[model samples]
Target: MRVVHLLRKYNPAEWGGTETAIQRLFEGLRQHRVTSVTYAPSIGSSIAADPLTEAGFAVKRFRACVPVWGISTERKRQLIAVGGNLMSFDLIARLLREPNVALMHTHTLGRLGGIALTSARLRRIPSVVTIHGGFLDLPESMTNNFRNAHRGGLEWGKLFGALLRSRRLLKDADAVVTCNRKEAALLKEKQTCKRIVVQPHGVPTSLYRKDHRESAREAFPSIRDQRLLLAVGRIDPVKNQRWLVEQASGIFRRHPDAMLGLAGACTDEAYGESLKRKIDELGLRQRVFLTGGLPPGDPRLIGLFQSAEVIVLPSVSETFGLVILEAWAAGTTVISSRTSGALDLIQHGENGLLFDLGAPETLHQAVDCALLHPELKSRLAATGGRVASAEYDVTVLAGRMKYLYDQLIAEKNALRNSAG
Candidate 1:
């Protein structure tokens, strides 16, 4: 089966959790004899298409203009900070003529999303839309700021957008997927979709278990000491990396050799700048390391997980924490915030430890517990590793997805026969 994936933009340099999850999902889908084509808006005149193409996926980049259809490479930074990028309506033509696109699967919500859904409907193909990032799980203030009802392609398209909003993607899709169970319930309450599936983000557990420590240590030498505490995600307000740095001083007092590494692209440049300033203010220049965004499935990422004594996730609003499974695959202890995702994935003091986000001191305690109590860390890693290997592996998740896809396709065919 061939699926067409739609997104606003895709650049390895600006990779995020959604991109990684989609890549891993595709990896699983491939095992089921499924192929995918990704479409995203061109960054002004440049698409940076080589990354996805070279990675062995078919790609089609639609041209877009700055402010409306696209953001210039220079302004892309600013756009990322504020969290709104536009896509052109002209992309619908590409969808209409898209060859052999048996199904449409959108990992993002934008003009391209509505177009993809519409195109799939016209072609009589089942469409699936996944809310990869559960923005609704974010703090209300953050949600309001990022999801300005009047902004994005909606504002740019004006009357046309009013006529056909992206919200239709949610209502019209044959299946709506959410990584977070809470988000799925909330979505079902708000939108009357045909189906809702809670498909958690997955990774290649077997791949992560490999021995890549040598290369990883070379890339980030701090791993050599094996006293690293890592936080992986975009440097944004919602991620709460600044709070991680703020808690560093107390952590340093307990374990002077401990190093905190923040790995992600800076989506919020202003927030990123503020983090740097806070690092300087706290005099954590040498202690807290900011390793800019690494591509999906980079050896360094797995290696960092392998090398870390404990993987700490301090995000303020995480719908589903993929990092928890990754830490399990790496046989590393997990210290996660008490968010919906973390709570769902972790069994407190059993598989992983969870700390209150409002309490930085609790995070400090969790970190100290992992560092000071070797037995607890080992127990946590062993149990979490088992869970990750058995349940959250990409292949296992993909099996579920294949079943869903088959079901949706069969239903669509039945409807066509009925109409005929």
Candidate 2:
């Protein structure tokens, strides 16, 4: 089967979980002899492109302009929101003309949705969309800001109309995929789509396996004698890193030997600087280490997971926390906020620990529990690793996605034949 994976960006170096997820899916599909292609917005006129030769997939990039204001991280997001619509509509229309193109799978609901809707309607092709974020379900605090920005740009009505049309596209698609059960439930409750499938994200088990801790420690000697507490994700407001910093300050009062490593790139520069200020204010300058983004195959990342005593994901809202699986695959116990998508993966006291997002004491206590009890940590890590390998492995996830694609293709063909 030949499929087109559509998104706003495809730069793996700058991408977060969504890009990784797409890359994994493409690799998996290639293993099954399925052809895949990716489309992304180009940064400028000088489009420097590269193909995933290993996975046998091609990437097509187009140029678009972006604004510079508000949070630095959000600037890129805002540009994609503008560029994806223009590019997707044109790109999808052209791609649909190719007879071998069986299906178009789109991720996220921003500009990609508009393009998917346009392509599907014009060409009568089968399409699918995956919701990776809750942009449409923005919190009350951010709703006004989001709306005002759209209105200021004279895009509020057009974007809303496009969203309504996109919903129709989702409703009529062969299937709509989500990263977790919670997202699927939300779609159903809010009538976002008629067909929704719960397919969680997966991790590459081999890279994040258990037999790498000693080697990992050798690579990063900074935490050699300390109790390492690790958190990986873009440093953004929604991630609630400030909360973690505050809680860590209190945790240090009891366990001075403990250290928290914040990994991944800072999504918002000002916000990241603000977090640094908080660390300084609480006198946690020494205990907290902020390691900026790691390279694609950085052993330091896997090392941090393997060496850390516990991995924490404190996101206030997450569709699915892939880092939790990565930590588990590395044989590290996890402590996540109760409200996150990791809640589906973690079974408190069984696989890992869960804490209330609202209560700093709950997080502090969970971290303390992991520190004081080696036996519990070992059990959680061992059990969690096994579960992660079995359920959330990239190979397994790829197989499931391949099966879904095959089914969608067969159904599309059958419908086309029946109509003829």
Candidate 3:
């Protein structure tokens, strides 16, 4: 079967959890004789390699724009960078002309997702929407940011949104997939979709089981004998890197040899600048290392995961924490904020440590526990690794998704035959 995957934004330079999830999902889908064609917004020609193309999937780029006027060029770019509701007439036209597509799967929402769903409906095929980020489960702070982002401008695209029924993406899709169980439950309550699948993001466990500590130590000489506290995610307000930087002084004081490493691209440049200023102001310039965006499965990135004493995630609102699973597969202990994803994965002192976002002291205590107690750290990593290997492997999750795809396709064909 051939599936067309739609994305809001996809740049290798700005790789994140969503991109990695799709790449890994496609990896498993291949075994089920499923072929994929990915559609994304056009990118700059300066990019050297396309990871999706390298993974042997066909990638097509379409012209997309923010459809809002009176916003500065910089503002427009920022809006697009942080999940703007972009409109793409080219994508709709392309999907209409595309040949022999079995199903349309959208990794995004808003106008793009509506386009995919509408096109699929017209073609008499099924549509699937995967909620990579939380929609109904977003924190108030995040929702406010999104609401206030493109204010004082005319959103001329409302007409297009209305015509496409953009707001009804979940309602229109045959199946809605979410990585968090909480999100799935909320969607089930609110949406009238045929199915709501709670599909946890998966990792290739074998890629992380190697001894890559030496590679990490060689690349980051300062962390040679230091206890590494690593955080992996894009540098954004949502990721809460600023909060982590604010809490660093106490951690440094507690463990003098500890060094904090942040690995990912800077999606929000303003937030990135603020984080750097805070790091400098707090005299953590020498202590905190900002390793700009590393592509998934990079040896150095995997090495950092393997070498870390504990992986720290301080996200403000995470639907599913893919980084936690990667850390688990790497056999590293995890200390995470109590987001929905962390709550689903970690069992307090059993598999990993969970701290409250409102309580900074709890985070400090969790880090201290992981660092000060060797036996607890080993037990946590071992247990988490076992869970990742046994349950959250990409192949297993892919099989579940393939089964859902087959069911939806069969239902659509039956309905079409009856209509005929």
Which candidate number would show the highest lDDT if scored against the true structure?
Answer: 3
> In model 1, how large is the Cα lDDT of residue 337?
90
**lDDT values of the candidates?**
0.80, 0.72, 0.92
Candidate 3 residue-wise lDDT, 148-202, digit = tens: 8779899999899999999999988999999998888887888787778888989
266 Cα displacement, candidate 1 (Å): 1.6
Q: In candidate 1, what are the lDDT values of residues 1-420, reduced to their tens digit? A: 988898766766677787788788888888998898998766543544345676688877887533444434545445533355455657778888988877888876655577778788789999998886674666777677665533433245544444456757688789989988888888878878889999988878888878877877999876576489989888888789998899989998989889999989988777899999999999989898988988767888788888888888998788898888888998999999998888889999899888997777788889988899999899999999999887888988987998898999999999999999
Ranking by lDDT: 3, 1, 2
Flag clash pairs in model 3.
Answer: none
Please give, for residues 311-355, the per-residue lDDT of candidate 2 as tens digits: 988987766888888888788999998754777788999999999
Who wins the TM-score comparison? 3
- Runs in model 3 with CA error above 4 Å? none
Candidate 3's error at 336, in angstroms? 0.4
Q: How close is candidate 1 to the true structure, as a TM-score?
A: 0.93
